[model samples]
Target: MLPKRSISKSKPSKVWSYFVKSENGGKCKLCQKFVKSSGNTTNLTNHLKRNHKKIYLNEKQLEIGKETAGPSNVNLFNLEAKASTSKAKFPKTDSESKYSDINTDERMDSGSEYSHRSPTPTAAKNSDVNVVICTSTDSQSQSFVSQKGRKRQQRIDQSFSDISSFSEGGNKANKVTNAIIFMIAKDNCPLNITEKVGFQYLMRTVAPSYHIPGRKTISNLMDEKYEVLFKLMKDKISSIKHFCFTSDVWTDTLNSRSFVGVTVHMVCENKLLNLTIALEELSKHHTGEYLADKLSNIFRHWEIPLEKFVAAVTDNGSNIVKAISILLGKSKHLPCFAHTLNLVAQKVCEDDAIHEIIKAVKQIITFFKHSVAASDELRKRNDLKLIQSVPTRWNSTYYMLEKFVKISEDVGTVLLKFPDAPRMLTAGELQIINEIISNLKPIEQVSKEISGDSYVTASIVIPLQNCMIKQISNLSPATDIGKHLKQIILSEITKRFGEIEGVSLLTIATLLDLRFKTIHFNSPLKLSHSVMKLKRLIEESQNEIINEETIEEPTKNENTGSIWDYHMQLSSHDKRTRRENGKENNAGINELDHYFSQPLVDRKVNPIQFWFEHKLAYPVLFEIAAQYFPIVATSVPTERLFSRAGNIMDPSRNRLSSTKFGRLLFLNSLELIGIYNIQIK
Candidate 1:
């Protein structure tokens, strides 16, 4: 009914004599069973041994005879003559002789090429003998062969039916797919990366068995991963007693889309943990009411109660401040200290005297930025390149001025070669630049020190502000511009952070820190007020603990005897001794006084570690520290999230949907803190 499949003649095997070859497998001539070729004869030999034992034994014996018969007995000319004569005598039919001519041609080609294992005497003798036996078979055997051919066809049909179950759902496939998903999330690779030619070629070369998933499939996997990680994050957050949130709104420049990024900070097991919890798209107006609702939704989604909310640190945006105030009374919101410092520095730059010198420096840097020749000439003279300052960046002006002063001489020399270049800064201007740098350097340093989320920055607010004020006030400027700059910076510092020490939240945190207990406080009234507030809180916490303990029923011993009376008396005596010792140690000492009596620890020590080590001694204070220490000094953590979001929404991936964009960012944030060690099963 159909055309017969042709078999390849290259490197003919002796096994082919007992089989009819097909595209994917071969059919045995002896018993009519199909065997998958898969490019070798191992299955064919097994079929012969299992279905036709006598033929299999004969084939094995023939192989042994060839090994025993030495090459000295094999005559090449005689073998060729015998093969030609045997082929003529057998006179094979078209179907049976199809392989006979091929075998003869192979032997001839082998002899001419001097192939190793030239026709052995036993192998030639066996081939000729088999040809005679096969030709002399009876007519009934021919009929049996045709019947077996039909059975072989039926077996081939059955084998084809089994191919449907072959799929890319194996364990190795799944493991590779999970690895690819993690790689995409960790590296922020575009979803379509799998569709690229080079990526496909790489997978084919390294792991040909694995099937790369499409973009939609990978997106779904990411969603599942996000859900798993979100639960892990939620479970972790629920166990924490206090949380401080930092939030900000960022607008993507390419698509003009806005996203609100919220990050949570807390102290857990003596370690400070921060997680980027939300990066949702802001489709509505960013009004105070709208933002308040969004913030509440985030907390509600995580199942964090309002009572556990310690404070929110954000920039001095009126809308966000009002939102936090509306959500958690006015006392729960704290202005970002770094943002306030940035305002202080920005305000100082706005002064006319300072503005003029900054303008001149900007113009000079601009000239070098535009001209290649002038820039190259300056590079030849100095290794430092001029830095350009952006208005929105903190400390950028000071950094630019600092660099310009270092390379001013080389810049002047370079400008002399170009007549059209902007004039170099005069000596008087240079003096002002140095004065500005000197005045602003302390502010820059203070900003960097306080913008940390890994340490107890809330406690450092009062002390650092005091240090900055003292540092700036003590500077003696030589010029009126320097003096004016000094006056402006001091005023800005005092105006912005002057009353920071009065805030009860920060005041208590500052006092609780062992490194600065009551040492940095200048106002006795505020200190007394903070002490009174702390005392009340500790009293309330102790009362609650006492109530909980009282509610639990004490266990009664059933085996009461006079023998345990001495143990009871010894316990009572120990209790009386402890009471007397407590009275001596706490005569007029409350928890605050006892805490202050201990020597200050080194400033480099982690306050969280200290509190954990001394929690039993100062349980109430430790509870308060847990609440207040997590309040970060700045909203920079949210700013960093927006920076990452910008990278994820690069030009090539600008069209990524908001949902996918958020998930990728969430996974990436987890990756940053080393919490994303998930395996897709």
Candidate 2:
């Protein structure tokens, strides 16, 4: 066996150590990141002043040390200053260049706080002259090493061309949209979703240059770039106008604080020009007035001119309405006519006689709905038509009122035409039918032009004509019914203790249309139910939030709502129960549940709410927009920029400064071929 070699002692690491020659010509101490101040510290000082001038420093000592830092003293900046005389030596490399290795070594050291770090070459190798090392303990800096190995320059125009069941989209979206998303997460959506779903899908469809990563990549990216994406989006959002505002804030089933959301929508020049998201977090003691005040402050910060506001719509919450009043100096509200009509029908049905008629009609409807033969027979009776009549159910009660009248006539005319059809009889039933038929008489030709005798039809025609005229008379589509709804909104009246006009007119009109419940002193259901509904709506209005921007949507690129409704549709994960996604994930990451479960106000209270509250309202607004306003908007132009943004900065390359995101969006907008009309090439 060979004799064991003697162990040799190795030198200690000289990382922070520097052999500085003392003024007495003796070595004093060593320092790592710091060395002698040459012409280097001068540039560093200037850079600090320019870049980090406002950043926090040990200011307590900086001012005092400034005067003492003049010269001569070994203690400058209250720290030892190394002399340039004894410069440290570094290794040399063979390239036939003068101290080439030494230059590389110095360059490597340039990765200090004193330097602006540039992206290091990916192919670099560790060596005496070209060592790859990181000084900071920050884990983020280290991730770059891996990016070099995995990242590829996105096929700028084909990012989403071949989504292997996946892809992505937007304008440096990771940077621009992420910032917006981050801000949203802070207040509205807490779902911890790093990648947007609909946008991602749309990216694959619209912009061919975007692609979503694999699932594993997405999960990892979520962790790393969540913050980056949010900041980027926010930065991009900071510069826009005419934003569509959508707000849905709610408490848990527990009914806690008022969590409000403010989303801005601007579809300009045929693109979704800007979609900004904001959240208004309120304490439990929040009120309409307090909420309005806070919202006013935020609007002032955004430079949004309240005068330019085309509309401020909200769900039926009084508080949100108050906020809108604050957001848009004042408003002439438009309430949902459909909702009012529902109320009217509800009232007319409340009468005992009308109630019996409704019951009888509904039963008859159900009977025919359940029987295809009866429905077919009714259609055939209406001039011998097809196999079936659409709307076999009673829901189209108004139109059905006319159809049922025909059915009754047909039954009476062809009473023995079929055995399956039920016979019409009974004095009481017939009397009720007479009332229903009489009310519908004038509109139809059931009776002769004058019946040749006035008194013959006075009992029916007088009341029916008055009801129809009254119900249809007060209707002013130009005025959103909800404007004077306060008279009917119990909460508003109770809380304010004020009387409202148009209440009786509205109620009587509603009764004529069979759209309202009878509100009589003798009723047990109580008047408060109606008021409670109004209260609920006002309460919801009191808690709305939204953002706005100015961009017109191009009719050519307009979204007629695809197989998936992007803007108007809710995110699927909006199910309130979903908090955290996978187990063992970072804590507080899964806040999406808070967003989906948020309480919403009624559309009646807030005009915006009317469009978002019901499917009918949304389409109604679309029709109104298409007809009244130039349906082609500039909002889509802004969305295209956002789409471009998401394209540039995505999960794969998430981190980005806000400034860069804005610049990219601006560039994309200028390059637009067409926003209003789809351009050829």
Candidate 3:
């Protein structure tokens, strides 16, 4: 009903003083309501808990008089009251008080205490027999220090002090660090971010108290983080028995430097994992030997099991081909499908009709892009903005032409407004633009479908190539440009991939796909060859498994005493020796045969998931599928890594070391070991 002020002036409680004021009959600070000064603090305590629960829960009662305060502190006023109730139980006589200052230590043993009664007590019964024990071993004379007739008047205050320091801001510091790293990676900020006045100002404005780390501190932190993430990834790689790699070399022309990137792919627990395994800056020669040595070093460093290495996909460059062949054997290197397609598209676009149309289109787009007035007028006509083609990029020309078609009328109007503007495209040129889009559309679609890193793209290569060639053959030479385009594409494809390459690893990938299963192949001879290859591979794997089992459990020869038993054993051994050869010859032939006899998989089925569900039915084949399915048809994974590196090591930041550049690129791509997983301001 009332609030009370603590009497202990030497040490006061901040919580009590703050909530219950000493003015106006103990007014509550939060509610400003007057309470009766009846020496009761129930109302004040309730008010603080109800009105300001958040502050009340987090704030600790401060010790005003102590040199150092702790989290745990008992109320001195309450302890004194408990001591007074227990004083009457322990009484002392005058005789004990006379010798209270004698040599008590000499009379008592090693285990001793100064007081005979308990210094503090919480019950009435325990306080009656409370006494102090000595801690010395010298038992010269037994002398009592206190009298039995006198009650103990003085009380000894006891308090437990907590020694651990408070540092609850560690979580906040971690969050800030993650935010800084995220900004550096996502926005491609320089490592010397703290040195820049603008960056420092921005960070200070956002968080005034946050201590920004120096460049070296940040770099060391990232290096430490890299080791942690590498261990996790290394463990995952070690667990996988089979995997494939996609590698490529990227030339940064502005910096005149080249780098090699390798991406690792595998299926673990029915889910596909595509991760950038290596992105190394190459300062040495780009010769076959140099590249091969670099790749071998990385494989050895990561402990990549070469015995399980299936194949590698790279561009058609001779050095790359030779390098991959050296590392993974000659039969295992796959020329990047997307690069071959780019070349085919590039060659087909070389016709005079297509060239004239692309030139005019580029001129028109450049005019609109440069002249803001022209762009505004074009935007008013149609809100579509034109995209200029980059010669180095694939599918860029198709996109440029397609965008122009959408805003063709606007362009015609814009050109009419300026007499000195580039000449408008003729009807024939416009026709060529539409034809180019038609011819290149299929190439663009197929490129995207195969470049996907998450699923089985190799299986679709043969089927998709067959479909493209058939589409090109049906063009019927409707125009001069159409005939030229069709001829260029067919020649390029026939020269690069052809029929035989399809029946190679590409067909093996398709055979693994239950969805396609030899149904799309037109040539019976190639189909039979693929089936035979699949059977042979499976048989080899089965033999390896059997040989290992045999090594683990070898047969033993023991002699029998009876002549009849010995004769039977000799005959059985001869029969068993012949059967072993036959079993080895056809170790895993039936699994393939059984799969071929089954119905073809449906068109809409997911190949990876299908293999996963049916893995137990054909476990050996599943192991083979894991080896082949992750082989991406293109080196796009490495190319994408180069794209990020390009942004990081820009012309202005050319002085950035390769280590910093690679780490930044890696952090940008993989989100720096899951810094992006945290939601930070």
Winning candidate number (TM-score): 1
Tens digit of per-residue lDDT, candidate 3, span 1-681 = 688977775554444553335654454332223455445566665655654442343333322324443322322111121112332211111112211112232122321322234322222223434323322212222222233433342221210000000011232333445445656766777777877887766544333334567888667656644543454356445656777788888887887888888887777666666766677879898999889998998788899967777888889889889998888888888888899889888887776767877888898889888898888888888878899999987588889999998778779988999877899887777777777777788888889888888778888888788787777677665568866777777888888777644447788988888888776787888888888888888878887876765564323334555557666667657646744777644646767778878888677777788888988888888878877888778888888877877887776678877776766665565542222221111
Q: All candidates' lDDT scores?
A: 0.72, 0.33, 0.65
Model 1 TM-score is: 0.71
Q: Candidate 1 overall Cα lDDT vs. reference?
A: 0.72
Q: lDDT by residue for model 2 over 578-656, one digit each (tens)?
A: 3233231211112222222335433123212232344242332222221111111112222233344445445533443
**In the order shown, what is each candidate's alpha-carbon RMSD?**
23.9, 28.7, 25.1
Q: Candidate 3, overall lDDT? A: 0.65
lDDT of 1 by residue, 452-528 (tens): 87788889988898888888888999999999899999888878876877798798888888999788988888888
Task: Show the colliding residue pairs in model 1.
Answer: none
Sorting all predicted structures by lDDT, with the top scorer first, yields: 1, 3, 2
